[model samples]
Target: MAKAAVLVASFLFVALTMFCEEATADYEGCCVSYSKYQLPFIRIKGYSIQTPNDYCDIPAVVFHTIKGRHICANPKDTWVEIRIQQLMNKVKKMA
Candidate 1:
């Protein structure tokens, strides 16, 4: 009986550990997709490209707007890529 209880406890510990690890995985908080129409209203404050890691499957570009909005855009989109490059250039010049 004692051996069976120990085995069950060990199994439960392993299962809980795995569950916690998955639950605690990092995720991008700004996962909203933005439309081109909204771009005109938003002033780009900064941007960052999130490369795929263990937690995320695809890459994403996060835009920080002056109006305090963090927008996540699909990096695969041609327009998003171009806009990111342009914003980066503008930031570089400002620095």
Candidate 2:
């Protein structure tokens, strides 16, 4: 019975992995992981907060780079907070 249960669990894991891979391919904008390196402000053009939604599972700060790359960042990181504050200040000045 134990071996049977293990086999079922293993099968389920493989099935879920396949399903997630297809889902990730279908929806290209979700950030499953964050970049480990810190990006400089000069390279960043803008940023957006990614809230958890259907299909997409994690919360992140998505930074748009000057080279047009989407960088997934950890929102809890200090540098992310500083960048957010800087963007907010710029918006406030514009308004």
Candidate 3:
């Protein structure tokens, strides 16, 4: 009985680990093209700048819109940089 329980536990651990890895892999290199009109709201919930990493080398600015969508924009884009600054300023004020 103890051996059976250990085997079950090991199987569950491996299964969970594999599941989590696959879920994270889905987000790897997941930058979507930027389109101003497609987004439903202008308000940004959050933003993040992802630098060059092992998986993806290109820098990207990810915008989290109020409608719970992740819009990835080019960091070099003038409009994107401007928007980032604006959002940072808003956060500073709130802090």
TM-score of each: 0.52, 0.64, 0.55
13-88: candidate 2 lDDT, tens digit per residue: 9999776442111257778778777778878788877888886678889888888778888899999899888878
RMSD of each: 12.5, 11.2, 9.4
Cα lDDT for residue 52, candidate 2? 82
lDDT of 3 by residue, 1-95 (tens): 99999999999999997764311112654553444432222567877766766765556677787866567777777777778777788889999
What local lDDT score does residue 27 receive in model 1, on the 0 to 100 scale?
47
Compared with the true structure, all predictions reach lDDT values of 0.63, 0.78, 0.64
Cα error of candidate 2 at position 15, Å: 32
As a whole number from 0 to 100, the lDDT of residue 20 in candidate 2 is: 45
Tell me model 1's lDDT, rounded to 2 decimals: 0.63
Say which prediction, candidate 1 or candidate 2, comes out ahead on TM-score. 2
Which tens-of-lDDT digit does each residue in 43-82 have in candidate 1?
7777777666566655667777887666666777786777
Clashes of each: 0, 0, 0
Score candidate 3 by TM-score against the native: 0.55
